[model samples]
Target: MSDTNAIGLHQGSASDLAAKLNELLANYQIFYMNVRGYHWNVKGPNFFELHEKFEEFYTDLLVKVDEVAERILTLGHKPVHAYSDYTTLSRIQEDKDVHDGEACVRGVLSGFQTLIEFQREILSVASDADDEGTASQISDYIREQEKTVWMLGAYLG
Candidate 1:
């Protein structure tokens, strides 16, 4: 609640795990932004289809970003915000000028897959730590990411 350093409580005491969760949240934000990029910039023969699908993905991811960061705060860790923080914490890389339609699709798909994997890993860690709330939060997100990935991949085939 206070910006006086949201660390050293619950799993935060386990700074390594807290840092890992922070990284995942940062990656989710980057992934969310990149999805927005795909939604805004995707154009080609499949414009109508990819456009709508990407919009759905970004919208879903936008919601999940809040959910993920809130879970971190609820776990007693500050939600990562600064770009410098994100660049250091996030495993995801944003796409700036992706032009190829398939490349866009591939990039998004890969991002979603990576997100799902990270969420699952974090959930597992949460479970191991007996952090049921965080585990449940990450579990819900993993489901959302999987569904989004499925929908995005379906468009390609």
Candidate 2:
């Protein structure tokens, strides 16, 4: 029998892909919570707009969180689930009680930046592993987020 993972990918490459995916999962969880905080705490003139936007952001993040975890499972690996693990693994740090709309937008921009860069790195690894599923997934995220980074930058200026 061939050395293959649950998803039929080479065992070693799938293991590496699952590990990188868990890292992405960790960052997404923290980012989701940060956006939740921003949605709840944002105030002032743009409250309604920013609040709604943050809600949309968090909701989308929640979906990706599930998708990433499921992908890890498909690769024959357990996804890291604890908040403690998330906090330790995530590159995006927690944002506490941010009420200013501009500040929240800046935070979102920073998150997109981190995610895009990391996703690109993952894409490289996925390509090397010949894991087309993971490569396609990360590519879509990077493409969407690059546009978001541009729009958020415009919002800031």
Q: Which predicted model would earn the best TM-score?
A: 2
Q: Put down candidate 2 lDDT per residue, 1-157, tens digits, no spaces.
A: 7799767799989988888999999999999999999999998899998999999999999999999999899888999999999999999999998889999999999999999999999999999988888899889999999999999999888
Model 2 reaches what TM-score against the true structure?
A: 0.97
* Candidate 1 wrong stretches, greater than 4 Å: 1-17
lDDT of 1 by residue, 1-157 (tens): 5422333234333444567678887887888788778778877888787788778777877777787677666665577788888877778897888756788899898997888888777777777776666777778777876887787678778
lDDT of 2: 0.93
For all candidates in order, the CA lDDT equals 0.74, 0.93
